[model samples]
Target: MSRKLSPSRVTSPASASVEPSTPRATRTGRRVLAGVVTSGVCLCLATVPASAADVPPVVSRGVTIPAFYTPPAELPAANGALVRTEPMSLGLAIPGLDGRPMPGTATRLMYRSTDSAGQPVAVTGTYIEPSAAWTKSGPRPLVAVASGTMGQGDQCAPSLALEHPLTLTGDTVSVGYEALAVYRILATGAAVVLTDYVGLGATDRLHTYANRLDQGHALLDAARAARKVPGASVTAASPTGLYGYSQGGGAAASAAELQPGYAPDVPVVGTYAGAPPADLTSTMKGIDGSALAGALAWSVSGFAQADPDLRAVVEANINDTGKAALKDASTMCVGDALLGYGFTKSSKWTVSGKSVAEVIAADPAAQQALDKQRIGNLTPAGPVRVATGVHDDIVPHAQARQLAVDWCRKGANVTYEPVILPNLGDKILTNHLVPLITDQGNAIDWLSDRLSGKPAVSDCWSMPLQP
Candidate 1:
């Protein structure tokens, strides 16, 4: 369902709200997008036995699109709380038909305040239940996940919706499946919170690229919101630990950076920043606009999102196509952008590109795209940990190393560990930047250590020379 997208626009970042179509409080959860539902979904053949008519009856009510960007009417004070109610949907193999039950479920989650600006942007996320039903832990900790980028702009699959296409699928085909992470974290009896970022999911601008503030705010805020979820059993005070790989690592790192200023009150005791691209320019230059060329899309999106100047910059040089692409990307969902809406191959439509990047790069406007790469913003307020592969390609080991160097130099209280990774190490992790993240081993164990009230380990070594 991915769509063509480009990058342009910026305002530092913020949001608002009107009388919502649905009640602020809904039983199933509120999503920002309108979804079509089919009846007779056959949710569970076992759950719904055939009736006298010998046919199962299921209801499929098209899900309502909740908001473009869900901003709380009232934001949290610097030390107060911000709540984001996320509406979610499940994955469906078949489109809805009369009386046919759709494949995914509709649910909502509440993410508390976590923005430095105290803006109440409704963060997107998916629910991670145990794959194996119940062997028995009393209750699970809520795993508040921060995902890597799909690209920048709304046209890139948005992260604002609770139900993401990738998150709903159990099978491995899902590109962003973080199911393993979710399962692993939840197997320890923890709930998972997968955020889709500020403008994604719903019909807002797609902020695909790499904006650290958006990343950090979306992530930290989700953690706060997750605390209020019913049956979630997690609290703002719950022993919390964070796991973010790639852009997620970037965001996790950013969230850590924002802790002292944004959500320092949220007890984020420990965290894992793995295979993160800590710098933007270096990462883009390192990727050399090759197959990881997708970063170009992200580059433009982030630059446009980081500050308003970027939008003005790109507008001067971007062609009509480029401008529309950037604007559309900030608001499109993955299914429409990456998946092709089943009308064509995903490759058929381009969300961003050489033409645009070249335009921006060759000119100062293009450089604006590169300039906003989310590097150079590492100043962690709490304990920090990092993990990275020695042979990473995409986010490149060098950039990861640079992040370590920059942050350490800034006295970031950083913990850096480089793993002897293989070519495309670690399952070629769904998100290309995973190898740079240093927080890879014993995820559950590490998170548990933090949730149990253990402090983060701050160990820093001289920045390993970059490749």
Candidate 2:
């Protein structure tokens, strides 16, 4: 049976929406993006079921997503209240449609969270309670898995990807590769909560791709929301850990720093931030002419979404090609983006014939926005495990190392691990992804120990970084 996603009526601050005057809201308000504010469009799903019709359905629909995702007139100020939820068998999230029994129970959840401008918004995600026993910890441990670069479209949300893995970015062999990490955390009997970020999953709003603070808010709030989920045994005292690689890594690291002020009540014990793009300015320059150059387009759109001044600057500097590329980028997932703009240079899209990096560096407003996105300004409250491949080209390994150095200087307990892989001629492709795969199991082991009350020792003393 074809089903739709329906909104659950719950009174919370996020349900009461208001005009967000933030830079992102202002720009989004002026434009008519597909998911941002659609008018009664019914988006049908090509149903993929978890089991044969005879077995109870693991997946079912509630209401049309385009209709359910749009923000309401008044959002409640309360953060992290469950808005709508539907019980989904965990197998529905696994790929290959194999009849293997699910490892746990999952609930597709829509919850309340604040956006970049501090306005309440409904954010969607999944709360999975693994059937495994909590063998090594006090109170059930929870891990909030932040996703890497998915895309700006509503379909790219992690919650959706969990259900229909292959369609997320199109041409990916193992669309459910991310599930490996989730399953790793689950193997330890720790429940996992995966977020779709602010606009990607919960609302039709343009995903504020890497708006640092906003991503941080979404991550921390996901931890808060997990406990309140029905049928889940989690509680306020459950120890929490955060894990994310690349874009997700940035969110995890940002949440670590922002936790003290943004969501202090969240008892985050450890954070594993692998190959995080902590410094956007340096990262943009590093990946400038690489195969992943489309990332530049995604980054600018994200900045413009958060700050209007940057949007105005973008409007003034971008040429027709740039405008079209931006418009095109707003609708594409990561796979489509790479294929469409692979190895493309930003200089070709600008009016003045300067590289987009150069243009952003020169403009004060753009510079400020980029600077704000950088991690390490504040120290993480608990033990932090930082991993970086020595040859990482996309997100410079130096910046990742610097994150550990900076946190150490601030008296944070930091364990810095430099992933030393044998040389592959091209550092861009292999270097960035290899560490995520190779070191992930160890990272999970480290986090599991932390949740089990094992004290973390800072490794900053051994790996000295240049000033």
lDDT of 2 by residue, 1-467 (tens): 21111122112223223233322222231132221112212222112112123222111111124334444344445687776677755534443335434567788877778777666767788899886789884988899999987776555577767766666222222144577788789879899999889777544345777778878888888898899898888888999999999889999999999999988899999999998889988888877777677777777766665666666667678877877677566555666667777778888888999988899889987788778788999989799999998888888899989888889999999999999988564625678888899999999999999888899998778866522
Over the stretch 1-467, how does candidate 1's per-residue lDDT look in tens digits?
Answer: 01111011111111112122432111111111100011101110001111213221111122233433333333344322324444454443234454422332233543433322334344455544323222233234445577765543222332322244442221112244444455466556555666776545422223434677767777776766666655455565565567777777787777777776777766776777777777765565444433444444445554543344554544444445544343333332333334322122112223343345344456665565455555546477655667777776656666776677777888776767776644653213323444433344455566666665556565665555423
For each candidate, the alpha-carbon lDDT, in order, equals 0.47, 0.72
The candidate 1 region of ten consecutive residues with least summed lDDT is 32-41
**Best prediction by lDDT:** 2
Runs with alpha carbons beyond 4 Å of true place in candidate 2: 1-72, 89-101, 168-174, 465-467
Best by TM-score: 2
Candidate 1 whole-model C-alpha lDDT, 0 to 1: 0.47
Q: Which stretches in model 1 have alpha-carbon errors above 4 Å?
A: 1-107, 110-120, 126-142, 151-174, 320-378, 422-444, 455-457, 462-467
| Candidate 1: Cα lDDT at 7 | 12
Per-residue lDDT of 206 in model 2: 56
Return model 1's CA RMSD, one decimal: 12.4
Candidate 2 weakest ten by summed lDDT: 54-63
